[model samples]
Target: MKFLPIFLDSKAGPILLIGAGDPVRARLRLLLAAGARVRWHATDGDFAVAGLDAVAASRIERLETNPGAADLGAIVAVFCAGAGEIGVTVAARARASGLPVNVMDDPAHSSFIVPAIVDRGDVVVAVGTGGASPVVARRVRERIEALLPARIGDLAALIGRWRKAVHARIPDMPLRRRFWERVVDGPIGASVLAGRSDEAEDSLQAIADPSAYAGASAPGTVEGRVTLVGAGPGDPDLLTIKALRALQDADIVFYDELVSPEILDRARRDAVRIPVGRRVGKPGIGQDAINRLLIDAAKSGQRAVRLKGGDPFIFGRGGEEIEALREAGVACSVIPGITAGLGAAAESELPLTFRHEALRVTFLTAHKARDASSVDWSALTDRKMTVVVYMGTTAANAIRDGLLAAGRSPETPVGVFARATRPDAKSVVGTLDHLPALVREIDGGPAILVIGDVVSHSAPWRNASPTPLFHTFQMAAE
Candidate 1:
C-alpha cells in the first residue's frame, strides 16, 4: 500500500506546511476552518502564493534544511504541499525524521490519503478506497451523496431530539427492535426518504403501539388482505408483481420451509421477521398457533404477510389458513406462485399443455385421495388428459401402477422436478412405468409428478433465465 491513513490532532498549534500550490491552499483552508494556525514553507525564501490569508508569513522561510539543522521542535505533522521532485525530496526527509506527512498527488511518499467527505450541516459521510483509485472513490461518493435526501439531516436531527423519550417509552431491546421495525417499514422511513420529515415524524410517533395502527394506516393491513404469498418454487427473480408488492409493503413477515431465505431478505430490513417454518413429514409449527398469530397481528393493525413456497393454495395448506383468517373476520387473499409442475415444465422446456396434445389438465394430491376405491378408471385413462399429482413422490409407484392398470399407455412420459425454478433445480424424464423407482434414486426436493403425452414434446432441461411468474394466477374479482 502506497498510502497510510492516520488521524491528526487538529488542536496542534501552527500546522507547518511546505510549498505554496493549490493543494497547499486547500489544506490550509481546512485547517483554518477547523480553527488552526498555519505556517507556510517555501524553498525560494519568499512568499509565493498571492492574496493568501493573514497567517504570519515571516516564518514561511526557505526549505534548505542542512540535515543537522532539521528541527524536531513543535511541528505535529508536515505536508509537502508542492508538486514535482521538490515535494518528493521533502516528503522523503519528513518520513526519515518520523513525522506524519502528506505529499501532494504522490501516494508513494505520503503517510495518508485524504478521503472525499460530504458535509450537510451535522451530517457527514466520508468515502475512500484507500487511494487505490481516488477518482473511482470520488465518483462513488458523488452517487451515494446524491441518493441521500436533502431533508435527511433534518429527519436525523428530529429523531435525535426524541431519542430520550423513545428510550424511556420502550427500553427493552426486543420491544425497541419491534417498534423500530414498524416505524421504518410502515410510513416513517418512506416519508423521510421522500423528504417529508413532518409526515415521517407523525408516522414514527404513531408507533406508541404498532399493533394499534394495524388497520388501513398500516401497510398490507385491513381492507388489504393478509395474502399468504407463495414465493414460488425458488428463483427470486420469478416473483409475481402482487407478491413483490406485498413483500415491499409488508410490515411483518412470517415465512416457512421451502421458501428461499434470499427472498425473505428482500423485505424491508426493519420489517419484523418471524419464522413459522415447517418441513414436510416432520412435526411443524401447529396450524392453530399460526392461525392465531396471523389473526392477532391483523387485529393489532399491522400488515402481516405469511410467505410460503410454491403455490400457497397448492398443497401448501394455504386453504386452511385462509379459512382461519376468514373465520376471524380478517380480510384475506392469495397470490398463487409457480407450482412444482409448472416450474419443472418451464425449466425443462416442456409445456404442460401442447397444441392438441393435452386437451384437459388435472391437479391432484395422491397423499389423501378422497376416493381411492371410487376413482373412475375410465376417466383417468383418457388419452387426452394430463395429470399433475402434488406430493406424490413417496407414492409414485401406486400412481404409476394405477395408470397402467387403467388401460393407459405404459410408455406415458413422466417428468419429476426437484427444487423447480431455483438455480439448483433439476428434472428427470422417463416413463411412468419406471418413475416410482427413479423418484427414490434422486435426491428428494419439492417434487412434481407430471404424467402426460405432452411431456414428449419438451426438450431436455434448460436454464430459467428469469421472468415474472409468481403473480400468474388470475385474481379473484372482489
Candidate 2:
C-alpha cells in the first residue's frame, strides 16, 4: 500500500495547527469535533481566532525561534498550512521530533494528510487518495451519502449497545452469526432503518436468547428430516419468510427442474445443491427412486430439503411424496409457496371471479386431472366458471375438445400465460375456438391457460415502460 492510512485518536493529545489559512480553520474545526484540544501558533491575523474563541482552548505564540531543536512533546498531530519556507520548516522539525505532521498542498514533505470524512454520528467513512485528488474524493463521498440513510448510524449505535448482552448469551459462532444476520438484514433491519427505536429494541431482545428464536426454526434432534419447500415464482421478492428460513437452515438441497437460479441463490452457502431435474420429453429419475433417496438421506441423519418451484402443493405431487415419507416412517413437513397461476393472474391483473360473469374458479392439472375420473367437466363448462389449467400446453387439443363437448361456448375468451411471473412472461389470447393453435404458437415453459368469458376481462401489456394494469386491449381493454 502506497498510502499509510490511520485514524488518529484526537482525544489522546493536542492538535497543533501552525498557520492561519483556509486549510487551517477546516482542520481545526474537525479536530475540535473529534474532542481534540487544538492550539494555534500562527503570527497572521487575517484568518483570525474569531470562531475559535470558545471552541479552542488556547491560541498561544511559539517563542522558540529555531524549530530544528524545538520541544514538541505532548502532541497528537501537527499541520503546517503555510505555503513556502515556514511550511517546510514546521514539517521538518515535527517529523524529526517523531510526531505525525502534515504540510498542506505538498505530499512530499508530509507524513500525514487530512482526509475527506463523512461523519454519520457513530459511523465515520474516511475517503483519501493520499493527496492524489481531493476533488474526486469529495465527489465519491457525495455519491456514498446518497446511498446511505441517516438512520444507519442510529442502527449501528443500537447494535453497539446490545452487543455486550448478545455476546454474553451466544457462545456458538455459526448460530450467533445466523441470528445477527437475520436481525440486521431481515425484517428487523428494515424496522430499525425506519427509525423506530422501540421496535428495534423489542426485536433485539427477542433474538438475544438463542433458544427463544431457534425452537421452531432450528433442528432440535440429530434425527434428520426433509422439508419440501416451494421457491415461489421467478421473483425472489415473492418468497415467503418460511421458505427463506428453510433455505437458511438447510444442510443439503435437492432442487427441481423448473426452480429459478435466483431462488436457489438464497440457500445456505455450506449446503450442497443437487439438481434432481426433469425436462420435457426426457427420461428423468422416477418418483419411487426420489422417495428412496429422501428416505436414505434421512436414515443417515442428514438435513435434506426437497425444494420445488411454485406452490409445491399445486401441481408438484408433494402429497404423494409426503404419503411415501409417512409409509417409510420418516419425518417431513411442507411449506406452500405462491402458485404460478395466482402470481401470473396478479401480474396480468385478471380477476378470477367477477359478479355473475365468472363466479367460480377451478384449478385443475391437465396431466393429473385426466387420470381415472375426469374433472367436473359439466361444472367447468359453465360460462360463469373460470378454469386455470397447468401442464395443459401439450394436451391443448384434448382439453379444448373436452371443454367444447361439455357445452362450453366456442366464442368463450381464453388466455394462456407463458412462463408466468418472470421478466419475459408472455400471454396468448383468443376465443376458445382458436386457443389450441394460440397455445401451440407459444412454446415457453410452464404455461397457465385461463378459460372462461372472464378471460376477456383480463388486462394486456403494451410492451411499454411502466406497463399499465388491467387494460382490455389498446382498442378494447382500455
- Clashing residue pairs in candidate 1 are 211-300, 214-301, 214-302, 215-301, 240-471
Residues 403-465 of candidate 2: C-alpha lDDT, one tens digit per residue = 888889877777788777776677767778777677775565678888877766666533322
Q: For every candidate structure, what is the RMSD over all alpha carbons to the true structure, in angstroms? A: 10.4, 10.9
Q: Rate the local accuracy (lDDT) of all candidates.
A: 0.68, 0.74
Q: After aligning candidate 1 to the native by TM-score, how far in Å is the CA of 125 from where it should be?
A: 13
Displacement of residue 457 (Cα, Å) in model 2 is 1.2
The TM-score, computed over Cα atoms with residue i paired to residue i, of candidate 1 is 0.56
> Highest lDDT: which candidate?
2
Candidate 2 residue spans exceeding 4 A from truth: 1-221, 368-376, 461-478
Which residue runs of candidate 1 sit more than 4 Å off their true CA positions?
1-225, 368-377, 461-478
